[model samples]
Target: MALDSLVSNFFWSNSDGSGKIHWAAWKNYRNLKTREVGTGHYIDVFKDPWVPAAKQFRIPVNNDISVNQDMVVADLVQERSWNLQPINRKIDKLYLDLISKIPLTSSPRADKLMWAPARDGTYSVKAGYRAKTSAIEGRTGVTRASPSKKVDTRIWRRCASNPVCPVCGDETESLEHLFLLCNWVKVAWFGYSMGIYISPRNIKNLGFWLEEFQLLNDSDFDYSKAYVASMLWAIWKLRCRMTFEQVEPSPSEAMEMTNRAMKEYWEVNSLFPKAPTFAEPEASYKWRKLQSHTLKLNCDDAFCKKNGKGGIGIVCRDSEGLFIKGWAEQVSAYSAFHTEMLAICKAVQLVEEWGMQSVIIEMDCQDLYKAVTQCSFRHCPWSLHGLLIEITDPVQNRSLVSFSLIPREGNSTADRLAALA
Candidate 1:
């Protein structure tokens, strides 16, 4: 690379803080160099010396010198001098991609990459998901019949003498046995990880596995992919520690380390502002079509905590806030949110029965509101069982219905009816 090009790509400040150089200024200064150095000099003297070294080394071997000096030079290049700027840039781009586009709810891939859903680019949650999945997969496989077909006298010999399997100890271990089968991996997974497990099939590769798990699972999945991935990373770190430092941590100690790592990851990744929750194109289109309407229906419900009695209320008002007529019904229900949703269902049914069009539905529950308007809440028991049931017949035609949220104070009529119920 030309000195001018290098100068153009980076900003520099003087030691005394008295001067600064933009890439353009630095590049111009470099171009003023009276003598030009060869590419070899640039790589050996400037690039290798300045750039941080990468884990993988790319040292050029030269046979120009006697053995001793040449070996020393090769060793230094391999051990410390290789430039890592390219790999660092790649990692940064990966983190950026995670924050800008990937959804948080994905399961981790085997390669240790997961789509981090937060506004910030952090991998704590991803690690948690991966570790949990790996542990579970490990446990599952261990509990099942061994894949190895050979029956051994070792297996039948006094099982008590070998309390711990030569392959796996009493830790309920399997996949960890295959990839990370050891006391260290078990301590991290079983001890720190709250006993959650993910199927091994989801893990793709070491670099991006956790990330794949995060990608594969949705946000509402039982296991939090981010949390699992964090655990996996911590386990890997512990492995490195054991290998290099000759230190072995007990299960409790490893759990503490896992917590600390997860905490730090969350702090770095979550402090930044989150991106706006994006709506799918089809959802956005449907939302726009419904919002184009004029009349809005606001519904609510209130239940007595002591008993299951509740009241359902629905009010139809124009955009200007004038009442178009409203209805309040008292009912009995164990679930208050269910009752609230029932009101919307009934209101929608009533509107359709009356042949009314262009209605906007308002509710206090966000989940219920989204469920009703999007027709995507079918999975929610109450939203599906109660809310959907009420509007099923009514929504069959050309009417537009939307859902929104209003302050509790804005729902005086519903409040009064609920009090009565």
Candidate 2:
């Protein structure tokens, strides 16, 4: 309201290049603001983005017909309902269903401008910049998704210096050629993008490419769209680096980058997300005895970052530190800490198998220790529920059972056994 009081809907008007610093941002605001139709007065039906989910939030215009900028949404209404006559006469039937579905009123309540991207109709500079960064339906051969559109300077780059494809150096680098038809881009889509096997058609239109590309993700895991977007972004960056900077574009680089990002994303969102870093106690490393009757089970796990395989090792000993039983096995695991939890689970199985009482399980994972011992996992992520429940259920059932953290040096024997697995 204060901004409106200052400039009187500056968001809707073009501030001419009068050396204003906010000109680029000022231009982006009009495109993203939608209209919430109450009275529909002052809401330009042809220009405003009022139709929900319509392409660019506006109805598809017939290029043959000249558009009147003065045409407001009120012009299409008759008796609290959308009159199809004026709409069909003007914008055509492309978004007639979407238009009719919109909630309107016959009363004189003023139309409200809304920031379309946000759930709540408010705007911040961060949201404004985000909207601007994603506005690429390929008006230019550039995208903000690239590494720092700032590019060692604040000078605004509209397009690359060369129109030719920097990677192939054969054809003009349009958005279609760069993303869909580029030889390098094709390799990335097939190799890095979950082996998307859509055969290349000689399609020049990106819209047609998107329509066909939707079929690439048919798996139970719904990560295809984000994965595909990441691939496209990587390819865009590769081309940008090659064109703007002196860096050579590598097809493998783009594919690998996309693959790495998607892999990390999958890890985070998957059942076994990456664990937070935990600090160990700052004391000299030594195994401690609780009681003479208590059987100390030292558990540790080894995870190969190179491969996804994990090794669980558990060693049971008397209070005197003499090993009574040792067990090791290889299995699939999600993270290093994940394997730690698995090791504890296996130790619990050993406890039940051996049918022992007065047991203490020790592990090298401090975070897991704190999470299991101090925190109730009921409110934690479901990713940890299955494993935490497995380890903690026995603890609840058995009064003598407990868990504690040990230093890496104190857990060296179990570590060795795990490595052998």
Candidate 3:
């Protein structure tokens, strides 16, 4: 009821009746999706915010118009496929391509409104409040607004305090001074890259500096921002330590801490799983060639916790080590071992379907290899015992099919395919 009232009030207050609300309040909430598109029934083709590619369906020319305000997206569809002729004439080629890609169900249902802020299309008051507060902090360029408000050094000093920065002890304490101008911060940021320099004269504000940094290093923007944010956090920690604990903080130590923190943050929040950390392969490690008229299958799996999904990659090579064919598929799996087992099972299925003779299946997973070879699941968990049994069936039926364990280095092609999937 409260949510409905809040939404009603917002729509009523807006003069244009457009559902566009200022998102500055939720800009700091990194997880917010912000953009939404629903099935096109009531949405105005030219005026409404249903077209994600262009953000809105606006005609480029001032004196000319393409689509009518009353026209909805459903009007552009005839049967299941898009009526491209009218749509192409109305919108630009880029937007037309994007629209064509939008999947439509065979049995179309009523247009449903969706919340863009959350993955499940549901909003929470707690998330909304946190996003709003985070936005405030970002605008003010402060770590914590409450602490800054409560601890007014001027009030305690009984006079106008100079507010010298704890790090450099030379400049006034401000967002710029604390994050950018401080000697310690400069050392921490510029120490690794002497080529990159932050000039105070060019930087109008901390936000502007961060934006410019992102533009300059577009490819590595995420990692660069993460590193910079970690550095700022470390600098703030150092400042707090100096003021409260009367401890002198080393710039090197702070940089080291920032590196560790960034690593942990990447591990936890990254969209893709980190590559397995393995030691250097032995000098003898290499892809072994198969016997005459024999085919070799190299299989690998990649699991990403962010999406709770996994990918299976299998490559077939002849006795001469020549590439034959490869297959990659995205699958749902709980664990890496499970994904590996699935990949092995998929390989067996492919071999059976292809009617291949004298095939050798190679994989890097040691546990899966042992399970397949031993064919004993007395000690294996109930969950994996069935999978193990299924994997061993092909070997038992087809005497020509064999399983082998290989080092990850020898399975580079499959590994690459899995990661790409």
**Backbone Cα, N, C clashes tallied per candidate:** 58, 0, 0
Q: Give me the candidate number with maximum TM-score.
A: 3
Candidate 1 lDDT over residue span 314-399, tens digit each: 87776666677878787655367657766876777777676677776677677666666666534344212323534544565644
Could you tell me the lDDT of residue 246 within candidate 1?
63
Tens-digit lDDT track for model 3 on 8-61?
786565543243444444444433432232345765566554443344223242
Q: What pairs collide in candidate 3?
A: none
Overall lDDT per candidate, in order of appearance: 0.48, 0.71, 0.69
Q: Give the candidates in order of lDDT, highest first.
A: 2, 3, 1
* Model 3: ten consecutive residues of lowest lDDT: 30-39
Give candidate 2's error at residue 368 in angstroms. 1.1
lDDT of 2 at 210: 66
For model 1, where is the 10-residue window of minimal lDDT? 102-111
> Stretches of candidate 2 above 4 Å error?
1-283, 378-381
TM-score of 2: 0.37
